[model samples]
Target: MSARDLVHPLVLLRRFASDMGAAIRVGGVRGGLLATCLLAVGSLTPAYLPQSSPYWVPARALGLDSWWAKALGTGMVIAAVGLLMIAWFNVRPTIYVGVKHWAVLLWWSLPLLLAPPIFSHDAYSYAAQGWLVHNGLNPYEASPSFLPGPFADQVAWVWRYTSAPYGPLALQISHGLVELAGLNPYYSAVLHRIPALVGVALVVHFLPRIAILMNVDPRGVAWFSTINPLLVIDFVGGAHNDALMVGLVVAALYTAYRGRMFWALVLIGVGTAIKQPAILAAYPIAVIGSGWAGWHVRHLARFVVRLAYAFAVSIGVFCAISVATGLGFGWLNAVTVPGMIVTMAPFSLIGFGVQNLVNLITGDPNGQLIWKIAQTLGLVLSAAFVVWYAITRSRTRPVSFLAWAYLAFASFGPALHPWYLTWGGLLLPLSKPSPRVWRIAAALVSVLLVYDAGNMAWRNDLVGLALAAVAAAVIVLYRRYLRGHRPLAGLGYHDEEGEANA
Candidate 1:
């Protein structure tokens, strides 16, 4: 036997175990195995059992009765805290890698892969629009309240009272399904989940491709992109349409990187059909068409031409869908009305300041002017960032484009939802690590928002205290880490080559 073969098997096993322990100390759990599972269960509990359901007895017994939904919300906070701990302690690198690791990851994420549709009554809006189309009424021109059923009035207050601002194409499609399904909200909700799952699946599939295109390690991409806790909880569990938009955006980038410009434009067009925010990706396409290394007037012209083509195709598709489904175009304009903006974690800056200002200036505690100002700032800053990035950065991906787009929308758009931040979270791994503290702070704040959204009573003081504490912690941790203190030594920096370009 060779000298190596002569070594004892137990000795090798012991060495392997030691190395794994060290890796976990550094990288946390690479797949976020345990955290993802906890978050999945925690976030979906409210969906399966309504707040008034008897299943909440256990939660009430545990002091979560103020809002039975808070039981799940509290659990999510604990899971997020666990994730942060894992991240803070740097436990991923030491985690075992191989089929066993992947199995655990899959096991955790699978329960969430298709958990019964829960949270956000937005899906009901989609169902209502579909029902409208089924009844041969233009969904764009009519609000859910105009319909004649319990489902119509059951839409979330924001959607029921507000004019429809969503692109008509998605509504038209949903309406057609409503016609086919005969006014079943549950069925419509399930159908909407199909696209949502498709979006998540697309991300999982294209992530490896994205890593390859960026010349980064596929393993890093797999661990960081597909299996992150934020991605699992926000996209998979929350069932937000932004997840699909993100998937399409990423696919477009992957196609463009492969020189499939035509396909990329088509995908971007489809994404815009789903949500108007996706139109921002056209900028990155223009950048790519102009070539990565040089600036040419001819290239700029070509970029504009490509952009025009994308816009035309997107508009055409949307119009066709509208006409086919009898959903008029009026809904496109309805999405812009000012309304109660929920406090999403990143956008909470506006919520905190605006709510207080309104209370102070008008002596009306429910005033929303401060939110308006915060949104204005968010728009101004986001626009500035996009302009600066276009001028300074050589490589632009769809994720980058979508990230900035969603940031602008969250900041300036009429309403905010904590799950909306999922858009940015999905793309976070693609950006530079310099913003790690801000991102982590955003995630923590999101946990608080989830809690606030679940429990109405906590709106006043509990949420505010939580937000302040999180913000303060982020500031302290950032200051220490910036000084080379290794505040998160167990989470050793795993810098992929050329990541700076992304």
Candidate 2:
């Protein structure tokens, strides 16, 4: 009840950081919690809120619908991302951030968990799809727009008419949540976060165990993967089902490493039923089951047999789930639905650029030649890498190698979302990535966080984007000139030279 009591927490946090001997003047843990709080508050703005939400009227009454208010929200987001980057970079293996950090991570997530959908409205679409199934209409056979009600109204226009591309288990879960919410769209959307939260819990439990299997520091893995800004923002805040899918995939990997291939394959099958990319986890599992020693002609037969067994078991489980849900392979037809969106994936961007260039040169805008070719090439390249990694690195560096394979496919495929990157980035810590690699990954995570907010701003309100850009530029200037290149001195500890090579 006293002012000192209220003030002591931050001071205590600072003291704790100092005791830990962190290299930075401010602890990453503290900064990360602050950033999450900022993001939670900023996420209430019009740019992030669903236009159909009942909160908008109240927001409008408070002048939160104003251009300046949107820009302010954007600015806050930019600042939060910058602070999070600084915090993550300061975490050192020497500090041994372990179980206590889990509490901090959970504390940071509370605000986000209570916030409305932040970066995306996909949860709205999820609710609508569930509504479709509840009404005895197959989601895979129909779009949300077909129903045309409160639920469909909440979906973003781009996906309004798209059939569900998610697996049967995902759709069934959504359907169940929707029914449990009494068919209320907003509540349904909120309830949809259950799967994501469960997935996050799974990751928190299993990632450290997986890290142990790779002979890496559990603290390191926990810090890098669990505290990752991208995972926090997109998976938790955005309420993407990829959270559960990737979590199941991680759990399956752990089970495989524990020498229980049957259970591992079953987990992989369940994960694949949540999202298709999870099926790819079977390759490494198959390699593990084959008892890989060294590449030899004789080993090829065993590898093939193990791979076949994996595929057969996983496919059976996937089919069983499909049959149980009565969704029955309709999702197979909708699997390519995501590719309909022209995103910033490497090949998609290239194809879009070439398509535009061709239109400019020919004065004709209907050509789809180069775009299709580029997309096909991306698929081919992704498949090639999958095969190459499966054959070569599956035995020696299975976790890291498979992580890169997932990332390669996501990056090169026709669609790339920030959450998609988390599928692989979460595994990198277990691989003992070098400091340089960590730095690069940190930079990517920072950019991705900004990109999600900026993209939303650019599409919904240009003024917001401009303000965010200005804020970003100011932060860069401060970090480069005002702060200089020196390590922070007041709080925790970092060894710049050690980290540079670590």
Candidate 3:
């Protein structure tokens, strides 16, 4: 047979193998039994080796620890790789269609939700915030340094070094719960997990509504939002607040699409209160409202009056909450402070490149000028992207606006933690499918977390080399896919102009 004939069968075999793998991983009797075993193992591993134990060494250097913990960690890495492969090949099962498929996904995700949070110390930082709130301090206004005793030691590194860049409301609520529960750190951790759980539920509940509103297939929505290892591992296990923020934003968008404008605004306001990043959703909400009003009103005067009332009600509610909290104006500063730092985010790539150049030229390994230049560029790019999306695309569905806003933020934020992508990942399935792009993006992100979880060096080579290789592969595949693809070409569910009037 010719090369083309041979390749065709090989592709078919590969696709079959992938489908079988995904089905075996998340399907019927055997799959459910395996999921239970995984969940049990995952839950027990955390109990045996708590995050605070010496097993979780800084820089993720695997030291002499319980052999079982090490084995579990290794298993996690392997499972993540396997899941990425399944998603990359689009190995969805045809055996059980529709809700049955989603049911299987939900079952598989239980273990992921139960798995221990990994890769970053942000959860610990959040726990500290709760501890402060329990001690009768306004976490919004008081730094952890002001507190004394065990809690002080726990938060000293973050309190002295890190800025409280998160919005106050969520942390404050967690804090209040910890205090009401009488200052137990363990209990506080549990309370912090509540928001993550709520976020998960919101994703599952609202995804179908969104799919219907956009007139897209709802079959894959659950897998995209819930079954994806990234969502489960980073947002659910890590208990990141981005999950809560995304949940609130999605909820508000769903409400708005249903023509409940006032309620949608209220939900959006609540979301913003949880995290300042949710403010980006306001642009889409306003756009949708304006378009609806324009179509219904005969005169511009009536439309203007309607828009004024909506703005008044939304702003009034937000201001009232702000005043009640005594948070003052510090939350505004928190929103902007992230732009001033330099780290792994895409915006910092230019900074990294410039810093290397300066070090090579001046023999000064630390060049302040190069650092400043990079930060300036990143800020400018981020601001410009946000402005462009708001002005040009605000009248579009909130999902599209949110997708772009999150991509911009993830690319431009000073520090791009894996969890930061949780926001965008939550929304991507709702937008256009560029499977090759998303697959590569997902694989690179997973690899980064895996490498970071491993020690910084393995056999004297940078452990991140493996991650970099994966990222490069993904980029190549994405470029190939996009060779003749327009940016919004396949975004068929919703029109950029407007969807069919309900």
Q: Name the top lDDT candidate.
A: 2
TM-scores of the models, in the order given = 0.70, 0.87, 0.74
In candidate 3, stretches whose alpha carbon ends up further than 4 angstroms from where it belongs are 1-75, 84-91, 94-102, 112-115, 148-160, 180-182, 292-315, 336-342, 356-367, 396-398, 434-497, 500-502
- Model 1 lDDT per residue over 40-111, tens place: 455444434333333457756766545545544544544444454344234333223533233334444565
Ranking of candidates on lDDT, top first? 2, 3, 1
lDDT by residue (1-502, candidate 3, tens digit) is 6768657978768756665455555434244435334533433333223444333474156443455454554454434443443442242333234224434445555654544444344555576677766666666566667765444444425343344667667777666666765675444554565787787778768876777777765554555555555665566556778778888888887887788878887877777767767766665665554554333436446545655665666666666677776664465645545554445676576777878887999998877676666666766788798778755554454566677778777777666666677676667766655656545555555455454434221222323543554454456446645564222223344443463133
lDDT of 1: 0.56
Candidate 3 least-lDDT 10 residues: 453-462
Best TM-score among the predictions, by candidate number:
2
Residue 42, candidate 1: alpha-carbon lDDT = 58
The TM-score obtained by model 3 is 0.74
Error of 2 at 230 (Å): 0.9
Per-residue accuracy of model 2 over 9-30 as CA lDDT, tens digit each: 8887875665533422336667
The true-structure Cα RMSD of candidate 3 reads 10.0
Global CA lDDT computed for model 2? 0.77
